[model samples]
Target chain A: MNADAVPLLEARGMTMRFGGVTAVNNVDFVLGEVELRCLIGPNGAGKSTFFKMLTGQLTPTAGTVRFRGEDITGAYPHQVARRGVGIKTQVPNVFDGLTVRENVFVAAARLHQARTARRIADETIEHVGLTRIAGRMVGQLAHGQRQWVEIAAVLAQEPDLLLLDEPAAGMNKEEVARTSELIREINKTKALIVVEHDMQFIRMIAKTVTVFNQGSILIEDDVHTVLSNQSVRDVYLGRQAA
Target chain B: MAGAIASGWASFAAMLLAGLVLMFGLPHVFDLFGLLQMTVFVAMAVLALSQGFIWGYGGIMSFGQSAFFGLGGYTYAVAVMNLGDSTGAVALAIALPAAFAALLGYFMFYGRISDAYVGVVTLTVTVILFNVFNSTAGDWYTIGNAPLGGFNGMPSVPPLNIPGHPDEPLDPGQLWYAAMGSLILVYVLLRGVLASRFGRVVVAIRENETRAMLLGYDPRLYKLLTFTLGGGIAGLAGCLFTNWGSFISPTAFSLAQSAQIIIFVLVGGLGTLLGPILGAVAIQYMVTLIGAQQKVDGNLIVGVVLIGFVLLVPQGVVPVVRNVLQRLFVRTPRGGTAPVASEARP
Candidate 1:
């Protein structure tokens, strides 16, 4: 990706204040088209808060978030999604009572007509390796499978940018490996920002990583550089160790 | 999905046929009074359907549905007296309540009122309307020639007339057909709406609002539309009620009447289209029978039945019956195993 090309997503001086505490402070980030970036940090390090602001889940108290070169500050989640930005929150958000296929179908239906949505849902389900369990209720699925279902639902939207929060959090090792592969495959066509604490999983998928600490970006570098940075280790890896 | 929709349409057709048979064929066995009583049940079923669509499917538990019902009745009564025409009055009856609902719903939904507060606000609105209507007994409390009638309630409400001729009011037999026809029409229409893309989105919102929003749907807009549609249906039911009893009353806005509507949806199967109708007709018939016997208070029996249904079959009659039927008959294609039973959860 050319550095001179217009980035797919750009956040400038973004800050979020909850009363007296500043959850995210003055974060500037950029992702190029077809880029795969991993955001890693300790709990309450403000990575999640920054992701929320980027995805329109939370409006920054100060600063701007631009998508495709247009300001989308304080946009509602629905509005953001409609702009071809797919978001999967930290928790798996799938309709429990609805079938896996129906879950994807509803998401696809948001962008396409009903007839087209059906085809998209099936194709997305198959892409997510959930074809066999398409007819099964989402609630009955295992935790990892439910997470994939949520991913499939987001893919059904055919978004240009995918923002996934802790997509591999509860997954077993095999599931995590599969998820890393899935994210890499998707990154071929769409830009992605995966927020995860698992270094191994991030190493498998991310070429570049952004480290967040104290509500601000502490470092942005290649995976090797970020892993070797002493400050990154002290604030994030040190906290994880404790 | 197509198969599910086809089965839904098939059930709708079956219900329509059954309704026609009961409406036209039953008169031969029952007397005029019996037919008249059946008309009232049909009207009540319409009211229950409105509640079912809003509360059961839309996941909006409203306790002010009676406000719309009473609004419809009063609109029809006042309009009929002024225009001397039932056709235009009927239109106004449905439109007035729908418009009011749209305005009220816009504020409540857009204001982001919480679910619990929604119930309280709606219930309070019904109570306020009931008290207001109850106090309008003065000579000045009149719309056109129709007096408010205060606690005594408005009497001699003009019956629905033949479309063009105001002098020719519908006879009892015609009124029965009109009520039954309206019920069938509303049922078919509601079923079709529920099968549409919009209906799927609405149901998805009911299931998981945040997920629906993340899918690019504005939940507030869908909620407002559903609330307004439900209000219109309730208004239609109120029009039918006025025609059946030839009266309008502040009792239409009473909390008891609103609670009874909720019971009808609960006993029938909340999300199922036909469940609420069945619940309403069955309960109304039982009430009429018990009232005729004069041994126990009809309301007391209804209260007991409501409690029994809530405790024994919380999912409602239709869903429980459907589950049993599915378990007994439905089998998976891969194996001869019985299909999993999934209850509707909002």
Candidate 2:
């Protein structure tokens, strides 16, 4: 990546205040052209709120979010997506009544022509290793399968950046491993902001790490440095370990 | 699931056969009164379809479908009275309600109102329309040569004359043919739309709006389109309804009318198009039977049956029956995997 190239995404002084309470206060964040960043923090630590702002689900009270030099602050979620940003929300927010293939088809049809979209949907489903169960309804599928379907749908959007919230939250061991591999593969061509609590999953894929606490970023550094930080352990990791 | 909804050749053939028997064979089997009643049921079935598509497919539970229905009847009455033609009046009947729906849907969906509010707002609109028309009594409320007719209604609404030959109106049997033909046309149109890409996207949005938005779909636009389509359909039904009864009245927009439409969709089934059609026929038949007797109130019986259906078969009859049919026909697993068979149907 060129040092002088514009960053893929940048946010400055992002603040979200709900009445008297500030969920996220004066947070500044940035991502390069192709990088995987892990956000680790305890519940209500502002990471989720910060993620929502980045995905255009919430407009911060004060601040600007820019993508590729274009201001996208307070833009509609679809507008953010059209600007080459894809998002997988915290919950399994896929079409539960649709088959896995149909869910992926909707995602692919957003940009491609009808015939092309069908081809792309089939190929993406195949690429995601969901061919065996592609015909199964998503609502009937296991939790892990639903997450994979959502991930595949995001992948089919073919975005330059992906904002994934807890992609592996309810997944089992093998599912987690597969998700880690998928994240790493995706990060090869796309920038990723993965807000996850599973340190094991993060260790498998994440390179740079950003830590948040009390509605602000505590630290941003290489994974090893952030993991070894005494303050991070005291505030976040210690709670999980205990 | 929207794309994969089963329309196998066998099912298609069966549906076609059923439609043909209703069109040609039914007139011979039933007496004139029964034939007229069948026509009425067909019109109401179309009304049930409007609710089914929006509520079942688009995930919108509108409470004032009768608003459009009444608007269609009024438009037909006013247009036919002014223009001295039925063809033109039919077009106006469909267009006015659809335009109104688009305007209303834009406000509700774009404003991001909650679902319950949508229901309330729609119901309120119907109530407002009911009051507006009910008070249009005397000669002062005339639109052109047509009297608003107040609570008396525009009785003896002119029957639809043959297009290009406005002097001769269609006899009852011919009108029956038109009504049956229309129901068949509407059923096919809705089926085709549901199989299209736009329909798939609407269903996807219905399943999860936020997720759909994140995937670059504007839920408001799709929802507005669905609502408009539904309104037009209901209007078409209303036009046919006025033709059937040879009357138009404020009662067309009453809350009771709207509630009856809802009950038809709910009792028939929510998602399946065929379910709503059957539901309208079944409920209307029961109501007709209850009407013949003097002791028990028809509404009371309807309420009890609705409650029973809700508790006993909440998913509606179509899904349950389909499941039963599937279970009864134990197909050998092909290649060790059961064919999904539109299992994810909306």
Candidate 3:
């Protein structure tokens, strides 16, 4: 399916301004097929805004976003999703009144395919190890489990690129370790752009890391290089970069 | 499960038997006035189901169910009046209201306004229709002609046309049977839909709209379908109502009428399909009993009871009852009882 074609997604000089404040500024980001990219930034560094723009939740003030050689600059969120990009939010967003299977089936129905939707849903749920709670209502799930469920939902989309916003945010150490493993496994088949604050988890899964500060790219390098860079260290230590 | 079904059917049969006895024996045992009062209560029960569909299950709070009811009533009145003493006009009576409801639902749902906006839009539509029917002129008007039956209502409207008996108009007995049949049909059909896959999706939307959107299901489209389907059912009740009275008036579409339906839904339980009917019957009976008390104001009594019910039960009678029963009788599934808060995505 054109797996080795040009980068699956490209954001060229994308900038997003909220009134007087620039949330994201002319950031050039690209994701090749099966690329696992980590997006990192300090608090208020516009990482979330960048993620939103990638998924078409927010329109860029300037610059163009291309998906598979097609310029899709201002597409709607659902339109982008239908084009094979999946997103899982940090917080749980699911039908609280429905059982887990029902939730999966509802999402799968949008494909208008066949019973394969159910099979896909089941496989993803199994992959996430949520079989025990498959019949339970989403409303009553724990923080970590909810995160996993959201991940499973995104996976059911069979996306080319999956955008996850903080999958390890509220998890305990064990849950975080499990999630790190899951992300690495998923990255083998699909390109993933994960926005995360957990440096350890990011270092574990990301081969390439991009750091942002004040809406622009601060450094884009391999995990080890970025971790040891003086500028990356200074930014984390809350000091001016030397 | 079998036992529960049997008992439920038994209870339903008992209620039906009692209603039948009263329907036939009321004129002899009590008076003509008593029989008529009961009919109004049943009609209002049907209207309550309309409210239940929009606000309870679809999570849309609509304050315009009465407008549809009024439309249904007027449609039946117009059709029956034109057809004269024909018994076959019953089909037209039902079809006209259902058709109007479909139109109203189409505009409201397709317009992408089904939340608070739906209530406002429906209310405005109701008011406009009321005025239009009231202020309509010659040729411009078809049935609701001037005097336009202003305040007094369009009286002397023809009875419904019953097929095979075109020479004879339907009597009150025939109308009562038709209403009962319709009430039963609506109850079963709505219950079936509630148990279907489409119904499951509607419930999901009510639970988490944003999640539904992300899942690629448009909440607005589902809401529109719910609204239109609901309108069609309510419009059926409205048609029955016109035949019951042989009259149509602006009071049928009043804001107070809408409120009464809301009260029924709230008192019954929002999401449960049968809750509306139970709430309607219970409240209607309570009002009737209270009205019989010489010193009591029926409206005040109904208002107070409704307020008390909403405050105390919150989830309505059926859900509260189910909760209590679960506490008393049900046991958790032995092995498959997952953690109550298990949020695993898959």
Candidate 4:
């Protein structure tokens, strides 16, 4: 909702360490409804680790995670997903043997209606423009098409909050543009927290950006303001900004 | 549509007819021991199917399906012995062991062990059970009136009782009929399950565990359910085994037996529902054909066959055969009625 209201997901003083290294440190973040936020960080910034903690794959060493006003710290990944939070990994994670429609149907099944699952699966596949190949095995699809199938699967979940770990990990300009449009579309109904390395893709979809460095939130601002900041460029964007 | 049903019935009738031909025809030509050996192979085929449910469809590779088989043997023996001479004893023998399998499967599966770990854990359990039963005969009069027969297993185990003919010991023909009935029942049940949502999820888990988990389907729960159901079926096979031979031996619990069943499942095609049966029959036929020629190690021959099958047709003979049959006899359906339609998109 807001800083004052209960955010869809709230991580307060979240810290995670792997032995001697602190992967994420005292990170306080909130994701609100219809909010599209991007987490931008340099390589080795622990963005993946931080995201893993949120999904309950790894427990935060210290912190409280509240999802939908309920404390959900250290919940199983599957259990956490049932609370209306769905995550799409950086790697495409579709059943290689299953058809696109089946993949979406599997995700839609979480909503608990056989008829609705099929209908939603069909709608999601069509919406994602995967209808043409909806009957093909995911393993047969091109890498970019496979990625859209993964997105289609997540959309079928009808998540209240969608956590996307780099939806454009490997894509050309056209695919990236299509993914940006898909992201924009998904953001209209659900809160989105996307971690991305592609600034162009991020700026195209994310209204606000959170920059992470050394496992902590370095700064949070509107996309335009963050991009134009001289200090932001000096520390992280000097080479890339050129 | 009629052709499909007719062909399905024809294949089934042909199998039964061939079995009858083997029963009446073979005995007319060969000896009793040969027919008995054939019966044993058929029983092994059923066991392979039971094991396939967990290992192939559910991704739980268990080396201890034989333990359920052994349990079924012992349970049937003990129940028949207790009942002294009733047909009801035969029913209880199969039912009790099947129940035990279900119970054991429930506990093993609900514990949330990894798939490979489940195999190891079950194998260990099987070994433990083997030793426990193998040693039970020593304390002859301690528990029951009769000894458990230990390593030698129980001999003179009561034969299955026919309802009105208590004095008649079931002949090879009757045993064949019973075995065939059981095989068909198992076939229909497993086929139905494999086509259902639960089967789809089991295969999905086999394809990708994490995706199934992240999508709200608990792989462990499904795995446990599958393992237990499979165990029960295997247990039924064991009950039949004990009844067929009128003896129980530790050989039923040996790793060799486990390996044989595993070979049957894998050499058949791991994931396909009917693959185990084909594998079972093929391997049994090979063993029979080869054993007829010389005194070679049966297990070693099975190993070579498994390796050869893996290299040539990784999907196993049943899948390969089905693929060929589909191409030859089936017409390509247009406008989304295709079999691979669901496999096209993801």
Candidate 5:
């Protein structure tokens, strides 16, 4: 990545305190355009908290988040979304009562005219390989398919940046492989930050990895470098192995 | 997709046709008293639709819907007496309650009140209104010439009249036409709204508020707007209700009335356009029949039926009927490909 080129997202001195506990401490993070990055951490490692701040789900106690050079710190989720940021939380967020296509249409209709919403929904549904069950209610879908529907809904927003939390958390190997392919295909046009505990899943999609621990970044480097780092293994991978 | 849309419109058209037949044909067969009773049921159906939209479609679960209903009746009674006319009174009856609901909803939703608290606040408002109106028994409580009758209730409220001729009130038969016509119009209008882009956003918010927010739609605005619309519809029903009985009472704001309105929605089926209307009309009709016997307590009978419905037909009549109909009509061919198998879990 070019140092002089303005990154797609830049966070400076990000901090979040919940009561007396500091959930996320001061941290600086940056992402380049169309970058594929994975964030890994333990349960309370603050990766989720940091992601929430980045996506405007939570207003940080202190920090500045800029996207394409515009300060968006403390903006609401909808406001951040309007600025071309799509977020998929750890839980599946698609409307269960609505059909698979309708879920995507709801997301797309916000940014497109009603006449074009159907077309956009169709394209996104197809992209996620859910075309066959597009007419089925999302609630009736299996867990993995429900997750895919959520991803399709997010993709329908056509955001320049996508934030996905635990996208492949409950998937089998084949489904996880398919998710990796989908993320890579999406990365051709948009930048992505995927938070996952599955190391194999991350290894397949991550070009660069950022490891979070104890509310702060433990390491930021190439996937191989981060995986091989002694400190990262001792603090994170070692615990996982145990 | 085209087939689904077409079928939806077809069902709507069929419902309108049935309504037209009942509106025109009922007066021919029924006596004046029967016609009046039917008209009252029609008005109640509109009330149920209002609650259905708010609770069923919007996921609001308001328990104080009768507050708006009673307000509409009281506003109409007071307006008709003071203005010596029904035209402006009718408009005020609908608009006042809607405006009130907007104010209340803004505070409830924008102020970030929880859903459970919203139900409590609304029910309390209704109880308060009931007490306030019940106490307005003195002569000084009069709004112009319309005396607030206190516990005795106001009788002989001015019936809806032609725009220019207040003296020539609509007869019971004519009022029935107006009542039935309004029901049909409200149903069609609501259907149109629920099918619109705004309606989709409202339903999405109802399903998942956080997801809708992430989709760039403000859930608060959509919920507030839906609540206001529901209030306006309930107000219209109340206006019609007052006309049907030629009276208004503080009982309109009673907790029993509010509970009955919720029962109407629940018995009809949530989120079904026709279900609430059917639920209200059927339950009211049953109550009327049992009340005439004077042997069984009407409230007791209604309570029993409601309990039975809740325990047995939990999804309500309309959805159950729809499921049966779908099974009969849309049978898949034997050995046809099953719905694409969902991915196996780890």
Candidate 6:
């Protein structure tokens, strides 16, 4: 058996519904250790719903989520987090009134001792290229900076599988490139499940892509293969089929 | 090291200086009766601090600190009347309220009660206690050789004696020193707690529970512990309140008491310990002044002040004043983000 023989994460028969609307329909997904996988989909395509299920934000209408070999179905977000699963939500969920260093410090403090957390906070802030503005209040930072601060906080968690939702949601071209580089550097050691909408940004970092459509995964393959598929263009790229 | 001494440490040092000045200086400035009255003000300031700690820092919308205060007063009165000693009674006072708070907090936090509902529910619980205590007037409602005199209250409640020595009751001057000492101790204790890792995490939960939960901290447990501590502090103040007049009454749990605690925090400033102390003493002094003159009703004036503060200075006095002073004194580059101390050291 290989060192990465067991999947790092596994979700089986994941489903979600709101009233009569089936937001996500029985989707199964898996990822290996030390791998980065991108999830791409159009708006309302249920990728967000699936991501929420994976992160324990939503208790699926029907499904089981497992980390390594443990059953973590319908676990609370905090419980999932303690099991070495960390997530960066679409919005920058941070302590807005606190300094950037403090925000990272709190996250780092969760899994480490005081001195260690402090060292990690400073390191993470530097890692995310926010060292210059580390003392500034997070609310006072620009949108892109807040996102990076959130990413730094997530990194401080030292999670086995880091799931990021729309990490480049509002970034400019320069910021997007920087984020992709950050993601690549991070992916060298950790596994990642990134839900993204930006295909151009995806090309910079994604080796394997999982394109989702109509509440299920349309295709899971190498990024180049998925990008060239004709049906993927029609469904996700919104191009007219020949 | 100077950078490590952030706003939190600066405020703590200022409070220590202020406490020392008040401890030595106030007795000389006031008559015997004035010293006794000042003791009452000190006790009430402690009450205000309790509410301030919970509602401001805990982010718990508790409108029932008066319930804990009243319970403390009544518990101290009953236990002291029976045992003829205040030591066990005083301990009971703090423990009872903390226990009650843990029970209430368990239900509220565990039940996942909404914040708005928490405020409403706590207010309703206080009102219920007021009614229940108001009706326990008959001789039949006695507890272990102590009377629960209902609305009339157990009058002439025994004053607190030196711990374990029932005969050695504190005289007016000594009581004033004791009460003032307690206030200062609580202030310092809370400041020390805030500077600790646990306190920082509590503030983090107050900032954003969802974020805190995501970071592997249980917000409910934190909220419960904070609410319990607030209850215990209010109870301690209640014991002092009972000793002030040598009386304990249902009126301690009155709606007026509930509102006044909020008013104190609102007037002085929320999220700061000194603000409540200042707010309580100043407001109580103003009320006494208004009481001395029959020209205007004190309640009406206080009510008007509450409305005025809410509309005019929503951030309250201390914060607004601190911000103004910071701007005037601290020189930062114009239009640049104001530099803040990076992280507070414990």
The candidate that achieves the highest lDDT relative to the unseen native structure: 5
lDDT of 2 by residue, B200-273 (tens): 78889888898899999999899999999999999989999999999989999998899999888887778788
TM-score for chain A in each prediction: 0.97, 0.98, 0.93, 0.95, 0.98, 0.96
Error of 2 at B105 (Å): 1.3
lDDT of 5 by residue, B176-231 (tens): 99999999999998888777778777788877898999888888899999999999
Enumerate the chain B TM-scores of all models.
Answer: 0.95, 0.94, 0.80, 0.82, 0.94, 0.94
Judging by lDDT, tell me the better candidate of 3 and 5. 5
Choose the strongest candidate by DockQ: 2
lDDT by residue for model 6 (B1-346), tens: 1254465567668879889899889999998999998999999999999998888778898888999999999999989999998999999999999899999999999899999989998899899999999999998999998889989998988888999999999887888887899899888888777766677787778777888888878888999999999999999999999998989889999999999999999999887777789899989999998999998889999999999999998877877887788689876543334423222210
TM-scores of the models, in the given order? 0.96, 0.96, 0.85, 0.88, 0.95, 0.96
What is the lDDT, from 0 to 100, of the residue A89 in candidate 2? 83
Docking class of 1: medium
The 10-residue segment with the lowest total lDDT in model 2 chain B? B334-343
What DockQ results do all the predictions give, each relative to the true complex? Answer: 0.55, 0.56, 0.34, 0.32, 0.51, 0.49
Q: Which pairs, if any, clash in model 2?
A: none
Query: Which 10 residues in a row give candidate 6 chain A its minimum summed lDDT?
Result: A233-242
CA displacement after TM-score superposition, residue A185 of candidate 1 (Å): 1.3
Candidate 3 C-alpha lDDT tens digits along B102-215: 676677765766467777887888788777766654454555332345556677766654665556766775566556656666666665565455665677688777666666
User: What's the residue-level lDDT of B292 in candidate 4?
Assistant: 73
Instruction: State the fnat of model 3.
Output: 0.40
Instruction: Please identify model 3 stretches exceeding 4 Å from their true place.
Output: A1-4, A112-119, A237-242, B1-39, B83-114, B136-140, B144-148, B163-165, B334-346
Q: How many pairs of residues collide in model 1? A: 0
lDDT against the true structure, per candidate, is: 0.87, 0.87, 0.73, 0.77, 0.88, 0.86
lDDT measured at residue A122 in model 2 versus the true structure, 0 to 100: 84
Model 2 alpha-carbon drift over 4 Å, by segment:
B1-10, B330-346
